[model samples]
Target: MARVRANPQFCSSKNEWKMKNNNERTAAVLGLGMMGATLAKLLLAAGYEVTVWNRNKDKSALLAEAGATVADSPGAAVNAGQVIVMCVHDYAAATSILSQTEQSGWKGKVLVQLTSGSPAEAEQQEQWAEALGARYLDGAIQAAPQQMGREDTPLFLSGKNAAWDQALPVLKVFAGSPEWLGIPAGLASSVDLATLSGIYGTMMGFFHGARIMEHAGFPVDKYAALLSGILGTFGEFIQLEGQLVHQNRFEKSESPMSISVDATARILRQAQESGIHDKFPRYVAGAFREAADKGLANEELAAMIKVLRG
Candidate 1:
């Protein structure tokens, strides 16, 4: 067990006396998939009495090897620990666990859900958990299991301030990077979904580019090397996009709508001329066209989302 002793006064706003008593805290994991397994291992490694429960019995073997106690049912799993952590597939899976666990009693226990879903759905579960006398915390892990307990890994949490403060010390063990998003459970999901979209969208765009590059006879190895460098410089996008989003200011700074639209159109045209399939670049150009059509030709590419969303 790895000892991660935090200061008693780490969360000064909360009762310092209570923080000290949080030691020897037991943790429960309701899922045994990769993400859940990673979480369970972290809790065990951090010296917590970890209880694990998975729908399938075979999934709990590795966790058992790590000195975790397996529960026969989700209710038993939650009953075994003060903190019950869940990262199941979706709302339906959550419901399956919840319906069964509520009968087993979930009073005064902290239920931290790190599952992936929309903000609205998170709130729904939060409300449902509250009705069952459980403290609900919604979280979105930005890092994978391998990054758990390591430095620079980020995880977003949102819930009641008091509950978050109470859980921080125990929760921080598995989270290299942590962001407390405030009382609303849905807020974390909103940020998470936004990030997930950008990540996947970029990957999809890059896939098309990689395919096209391979077809064009560019040594793809160099492109992978070059890709990192190109993406590494997108910090400006975060800054500019934040301002454009928060202030509704979409005035062009670097690449204007007309310029990007023209460039993307050219890329699509080139792909079409080469008898290659091109949808990603065309969709990018389509977004630019929306901004241009709105007479915001001077705005940046990020502004197109706002325009199209509007």
Candidate 2:
């Protein structure tokens, strides 16, 4: 359940409608980029009155056709709703429009910024919003725009209690899992970027490995069988990984058999001799050689994980 929040703008009987009206729930999304437009479509679909603002006049037209109200300017978009969602490309674009409201007051609105950026950027944007009197929340979109509105895609969130309290009810309208880290704005952003970095790093390693295998005459399509077989044992690998990592022991649990090294080194040396594969073996073998030279030769190839940690 979303925690009830008292918006600073809420006054006495004159502001009673802001507190009690169901139809009063509305959202404003600035920026009509892929992610921004996607989020606007989602809010509209979820039955919230949605308003949108985009610098490019034509950008908001599609959302407008999808039952969103397009505003001429950023301030107009924010004025149309109590909850404003900013999904610009980054901090600069979001701040460019939002900075327009600095001289004016923005006391009552809830601002949920979905711009993807560094932790420092999230923290800076939080302070920028506070200067305008708006409650700010930092949020991360863990999936592509096409995945928006899907259940459990993963969103990272953090900010003041008031901002989170007001936004949690709308999580059903966004993508996959929604994780609230803490009150500090950038905590979630840091996790999001770090997670993506790991994803890309693994992808590069997979691509490089697959390419090298193919260059050595092992076509990837044929190799996928072995790859699939290996992947099926991922849980076991992870278990062993945990044991190795925690115990600080990367010993001969899974020996690099002579057959395995002979086969791999045949490819490694062959690729190096042919100038087809570059220094991959340097990094791979360098760690193993370090272990092998250290008289840990009896330890399994998995022990290289320990050497690399060094």
Candidate 3:
């Protein structure tokens, strides 16, 4: 079994660590899924010596054609790189791959896990990595596979400060802006999940809106075009809402809870009348009404945070 005998040490200071040459910085990508393949390609484009390994040998062939060294096994891949990135399906799959690899090869390696998982799972993975004397960084990729090498690709990362510093150079190659959340291994996952929650909520609203418009004999494409205009202003609204929630001052209102509740009630009625599924509208109306019932009727729409907290 291959084992990493020495940890890749870097200065604790924030100053950038210089490599003897770009080729000296090696990275190994464990999975060759869409996102993982894109990442490996980005590293290769950045001139890093990249080693790739996938469960299916055929998957690594494409990367090899692009100048990546294909490893025969996970242990060989781990041994070939200083920075090891895993983009497997989930925390379980990631651990399973690692378990099969020579355990000793983990020492002194920096393991960047971009697997989708809960915060608790990230923490567990961090502990497991630490036990093996490996530095672990939990990360979440905020962009799609096609956006991997773009300058705007955002990667949320959390881990020990020293380890983060050590891994920054290789990480910067893939992410245009790699945000360091904190030392807690689970922070990146938590933030990622929170961000996803808001995105999914907005998507559900759009889906419901589209369904309602279709039921009303309206052009769905036209509705989508009109919605795009309104969606552009959501960023400003979100900023204001965040400020209000942070300050615990939801009194001043652009749109009060009562008004939103009433508006949502109308939406529920429309869905019901059109014989369309009202589940999404009903769920939203319930939250708005709950806020109003809590005596926050005059408060801004941001006051719904109270109901959410409960």
Candidate 4:
């Protein structure tokens, strides 16, 4: 068992006293996948008495050897700690475990769900936990297992103020600053989905660019390296574009929509000429063409959001 030590206060509000008074030195982890196991290990290393449970008991061996109490059942794990962190495959797996747990033991517990799920699932889970008298917090871990416990690791959380206060110390073990989006439990999941879209959208463009490099006989590694070098500047541009969209001020500033319109068309044309797949380029070009037709060619690149809104 890990040593129990008084957690240092991290908040300056009135809830500071309550947080210190209710500081829990025990935590329960209700999943053993890579992310879940990483969380449990971090908690244990922080000197918390960690209780862990997984569907496959064999997965608990390493954690048990590292001074963790391996619970035979989810209910047992829940009963062992005041703060219960659940990070499973999906909402379905999490729901199955919830169904098997003793509902009565949930009262007064802080249930932090780090599972990847839809906003609706998070909303529903929050309601379910509230009905059982548990403080529910929905969180999205925006980092991989190896990225855990980093000062810059992104962890978005949303829940009641009291719940946030109660879980602050435990959350800090994983992230130096856990971003509390708002009181709505679904906010974290919604942000997670939006960020995922950005990631996949960039990936689609990268794949098409890779094809272009391959067809042109250019070194793909050089292309990738160039992208890596310019990504920071590109990210700043993206942030500016996001601001423009958020403020609904799309007046041409840095880059005009007409530029992307021409660029995307050239990409599509090249795809056709090279006899490579054109689906990605076609979709991108089609969007820009639509925006151009909508008289947004003179606007900023982020004016594309107007078309997206439609």
Native-to-model Cα distance after best TM-score fit, residue 14 in candidate 1, in Å? 26
Report the lDDT tens digits of candidate 2 across residue range 1-310: 0112222332233135435664356778888888888888787666676778888868876666566777777877777777888887777877789876533546677788888888888888888777777788899778888877767587889898888877775655895467788878998888888788757755655665787777777888777667667765875865676577677775566645233344546656765776764556555545455666666667555565555567
* TM of each candidate vs. truth: 0.88, 0.74, 0.91, 0.92
Poorest lDDT segment (10 consecutive residues) of candidate 2: 1-10
The residue pairs in collision within model 4 are none
Q: How far out, in Å, is residue 66 in model 4?
A: 0.6
* Candidate 3 lDDT by residue in tens digits, 1-310: 2221221231211012225553247889999999999989888767676788888877877677666778878989998888999998998889889997887988888899999998899989899888998999999998999877666888999989877987898788877778899878999999999999999999899999899888878999999999998887988889889999999988866777888889999999898888899999999888887887899889888888888799
How large is the C-alpha RMSD of every model relative to the true structure? 6.1, 7.4, 6.0, 5.4
Off by over 4 Å in 3: 1-24
- On the 0 to 100 scale, the lDDT of residue 265 in model 4 is 96
| lDDT for 105 (candidate 1) | 67
Model 2 lDDT at residue 110: 77
By lDDT, the best candidate is: 4
lDDT winner between 1 and 4, please give it.
4
Whole-model lDDT values for every prediction: 0.78, 0.71, 0.84, 0.88
| Model 3, global lDDT | 0.84
Which residue pairs collide, candidate 2?
151-176, 152-176, 152-177, 153-176, 153-177, 154-177, 252-300
lDDT of 4 by residue, 81-150 (tens): 8999999999999999999989899998889999999989998999999999999999999998999999
Model 1 RMSD in angstroms: 6.1
